[model samples]
Target: MINAKEAFLKASTELKENGIENSTYEVREIFKELLKLNPFDIDFAQKELSQSQEDLLNDAVNRRKMHEPLQYILKKWEFMSLDFNVRSGVLIPRQDTETLVECALEVVKQNNFTQCADLCTGSGCIGISLCHYSKGLFTQGYDISDAAIELATENAFLNSCDRFIAKKHDVLLSAIGKYDIIVSNPPYIKTQVISSLQSEVKDYEPHLALDGGESGYEFYKAIIPLWKNALNKGGYMCFECGEGQAEEIVKLFEVNGFSQIRTFKDYNKIDRVISAKLL
Candidate 1:
């Protein structure tokens, strides 16, 4: 029977050979999950694996070999200091998106926008995080997909945003009430680029949460104008954009009559958030 250390090394090597970039961490998380033992736990240090435990490790190894996202396997993901439940149909919350939340919080803090809307609020990460951090704001989250709405509500509840409402509303067609701050990390990966993404994203994640049309700015184009009437006068709009999209997104807001257009960079210095106010 294989021991935990031997099992982990073998699984890590196999995952690496299959192109998993973070093989060691993946293997460690898998071991900790299956054995219910932390890496530093004395029990893990002394335990011998039973046959069932060995089989579970082998199953996880095989799943990893198939390029399944570790987050999907774990059914949870972290964003903005919170853990969100994730399934195959929902977008996996990403750290890059935290920049959107941060920008929104800062805008509200600076301008005192207490009513906000999170459009295309998959998993409710943006609005929920804002509610958690902003304290006094009333936040609402909307998504077109029923599955996404369900998961978003669950996430909102988990994050203690019971006052935050998650609803099913397609941004392309729905008429939402005015808000002092509007924000989204909408689907922005170009349709063509979707197929070219790493398998962990292209294969495992929801296409509805990706596939941002031919030029990758369809949602921004469609929603920015709709938001023109939905934002209170002098209210702010902020969005998370894909790489190389900040300038075009700023242009979209400008064309829609938004002023004071600004772009902020993520920690990696990528132009990741675009902010503007209705003139």
Candidate 2:
């Protein structure tokens, strides 16, 4: 048995020694997730974790030391203030992608768009969030990975998004259905640069969801024109872009006859999201 405070400090030290940033925060989360203890509460010191709980905490920390993503270890993450189920085979939802969702929501509300197509949907975070927030919106999400489809289906149910549908599909092949809004946060990392990414990403995250081909714009290139006709006239297409890649994506939208292209920056002021409308 171990007291909550002791377990927290031990985990924090181990993670810090392993060069993990935000070690304290991660420890707090681990305690909450595994042991169901809130380290910040006044009674936290009075709580003791059973031996089994301690073992679970230790195992989680050990996984972190191996450079596994904390989100994957926890099997859950938050995007757009909504909880999402995530695991090894599925790409974890990210805060950066929230910018894309926010832009899509605005388009949905402004035009009262009822249907949304989420291409390359990983955890279905983008589509699920849209359906969660919009009463009339129905979203169809497609991904190449069966794991993603399964998890996304579970997540939509978990989040009470009855209108959200997850389907197994390769977005590179062809467009499927018509929609008033289409959004994607597809693979945008350059193939050569992916090897140099942090171990938590390069070693643990799925490469099928990371490799964006040589120019890091392969998905955007294929998605823009392929899905253009699938988008209703005056409908919107939103994308989460990599750093310095937004400009090129905007050009692709223009060449595909999209108009009113707009770019939004993430918290870091990086060009992170681009939204364009079918002409």
List where candidate 2 sits over 4 angstroms from the true fold.
none
RMSD of 1: 1.6
lDDT, candidate 2, 1-279, per-residue tens: 788888889899999999999999998888888777888899988888899889889999999999899999888998898989889988889888989988999999999999999998989999999998888999999999999999999999999889999999888898989999999999999999998999999998899999899999999999899998899889999999899999999999999999999999998999999999989
Candidate 1: what lDDT? 0.86
Name every residue pair that clashes in candidate 2. none
Query: Per-prediction count of colliding residue pairs?
Result: 0, 0
Tens digit of per-residue lDDT, candidate 1, span 192-255: 9888899888888889989899989999999998877888989999999988999999888888
| Alpha-carbon TM-score of each model against the true structure | 0.94, 0.98
**Which candidate tops TM-score?**
2
TM-score of 2: 0.98
Highest lDDT scorer: 2
